[model samples]
Target: MKKTILGLWLLACLSLNALAENIYPISREMGSGTRSAFVDIFEIYKSVNNKKIDAIAQKIEITNSTGIMLTSVANSKNSIGYISLGALNNSIKPISINGVIPSVENITNKSYTIFRNFNVVTKLSNPLIEDFLAYTVSLEAKPIIQKAGYISVSKGNFKSKNPRGKLIIAGSSSVTPLMEKLKESYVKINPNADIEISQSDSTIGVNSVIEGIADIGMVSREVKESELKKGVKPQVLAIDGLAIIVNHQNPITNLTKEQVRKIFLGEITTWEQIQ
Candidate 1:
């Protein structure tokens, strides 16, 4: 009789814990180009006395890279986050925005609007850098880009001059996978070329190029005006969207743009509120 009473009390506590589950909004740390693009597309900015400022909740979970974003959302049953569509995998579920599902065809046809450009920034020009950058945007790279789940937006040509030099690429984790594929092909053509990729957020990539620390910067968002002013030239490599992902346990599949905007803006605080 005492054992039965203890089991019932434990069950009651479990039920209460489930009932108290609330939505956890996860965001990337500052200086992430992905965060900038998501915030801009979702209109998460607020005008306070005519001065615009970011309005993401002050206490939300913040991650440093795309991989971490996926891990955080996948680990938490109530967490919601965003990542590059190309980097998306089976670990988490991507909820459709509005009625449009995120797919390569949908993104290509303009049905999926929450997308950003994958750019490579270069502050100085050289033979190896020029060849590598051209190869990334050329028609030859399309198959690799497509295979990696990103949309190709360029059809330029690449001819192997067999340029030999060491080059460093630093930037967005979203673009690193595609870049690695391209690096393999480029190195085969020019065996003497050594390519190194250091993955981080987009802002760091662009800044690394501008500061002369890296030869190429992988920026997932459009090149900023300030960065352009600083003389880092951008070349579009591919196009990708930010996928709204949640833990696989979350049953809610589709969210309207308004609901998403509100959630990110901190207006909607609980899972029950959205349901």
Candidate 2:
């Protein structure tokens, strides 16, 4: 009789634990450049043939901003998501994919494949613009970028000219945090400079520069061929990796790319399926 009572109590505890856990999948909104690069790199398209098909059906929480995505995943113990490595923090855990971890060493050696370029779009260049661009790839800026969790571009030979003017940089939310750091450092040397930043999607940033709405547009991915025809020039800024993150409490250490693909496709709905 005691054994039967103990078994019933244990079963009840297990049931309660199960009830407390729920898996949440989060994604960025439709127009984000980060979303575009992520889907393209993962081959998340529905069609196997040379034709278009419906997108994969999955119940996901769509966030308009990277900040919200970070917050949502940080609060849920069973949630999984992705964010730029620059935005990574200890609030959540990043997982290994395909037997490799996301790190500067991996990225520097080209072992990490899920990276995109930081780009700036401009309609016309002037001395002031050229100076600011040079500062971005200078030796001094490298450590600032590295400290912010991003890889710096090659230190170029361009010399810094004192640029003093109001510079408006607008675009990719993923790039905004890193840009803010750059802005802080830039203004310190050029106290006469006024730098303003805005976070719309990347496409808007490109368009803003082309239309003269902003002095420079920040883009997380390479400038699309379509946008190039609009007479906008692209300057490569930095290289950033995308980190696949999950709640720190999740015990799963590594995920194969195929497993991640299936999970996002809604084919693997339960954590038990992977276990």
Candidate 3:
């Protein structure tokens, strides 16, 4: 009889704890460009409000091998999840981080305050990594990074100086064009520097960097605060515009910020009423 009573008490306690805890699985890497940006804002939440996050929420059960699997698990009404602002495809909704939604305008203006630039991170010890890092800081890669959904760090003369060895680069698809451009431009000046580029999404890229799979990782979004322990460096590449695109057939050319908010909030549906 005592065991039964104890079991019930334990179950009640577990249920209550579940209700209070919110789990968020963030990438594991410190200074990862994407995760760092996200974590910075998450830290603010922890600072202002005494909210705790469980990084390993639950051992999510998965059968399919796809990124959508994570999104599906995260989208459960019982859970709050986050994905790259560029990759948000209606599967999961981002919860408000300090009362601001992650949007292009808000991120650019620093109003949303959580968005970060996708970076090109490489080891400081490697001469090749140093060279590539220097190359990325150039003016040429700026436009490419902006197109991929990130803010660039403005520095002058990226490729003028060459570091001594082989260069290996990795990360998001969004950053591929810029990396390719960097490689092509650098090889022309230093014909002996061996350079290779690999592609992965933000989560996978960060994981690779943590595991030492590549010299650098490219991420499309900001990193979460929990991921900052992994020693990755996030550098801003360019400012990207996240536009709310509509079908060309629609006559609407411009939408006031309030109207756009209303549409997303389900307050307005009809196109006729928008005019």
Q: Report lDDT (CA) for all predictions.
A: 0.88, 0.81, 0.52
For residue 63, model 2's alpha carbon misses the true position, in angstroms, by: 0.6
Question: Which of the numbered candidates is closest to the native, going by highest lDDT?
Answer: 1
Candidate 3 steric clashes? 20
Tens-digit lDDT string for candidate 3 (116-182): 4555554344666666676667776666555544566758766545555776677765556556766
For candidate 2, give the lDDT of residue 92: 91
| Best-performing candidate as measured by TM-score | 1
In terms of lDDT, which candidate is stronger, 2 or 3?
2
Who is ahead in TM-score, 1 or 3?
1
Candidate 1 vs candidate 2, TM-score winner: 1
**lDDT per residue (tens digit) for residues 1-275 in model 2:** 99999999997776455435555778887767787777777766776578533253457788887898899999997888888988888899998888789988899998888888888889988777777878888888888889988888857544556666788899999989988998898877777778899998788899899889998998887788989999999988888898889887676667777777776777776665665
**Per-candidate TM-score against the hidden true structure:** 0.90, 0.87, 0.51
lDDT tens digits, residues 200-238, model 1?
A: 989999989989999999998889888999999998888
Model 3, runs deviating above 4 Å? 1-116, 139-152, 158-165, 256-275
Candidate 3 has its poorest 10 consecutive residues by lDDT at: 56-65
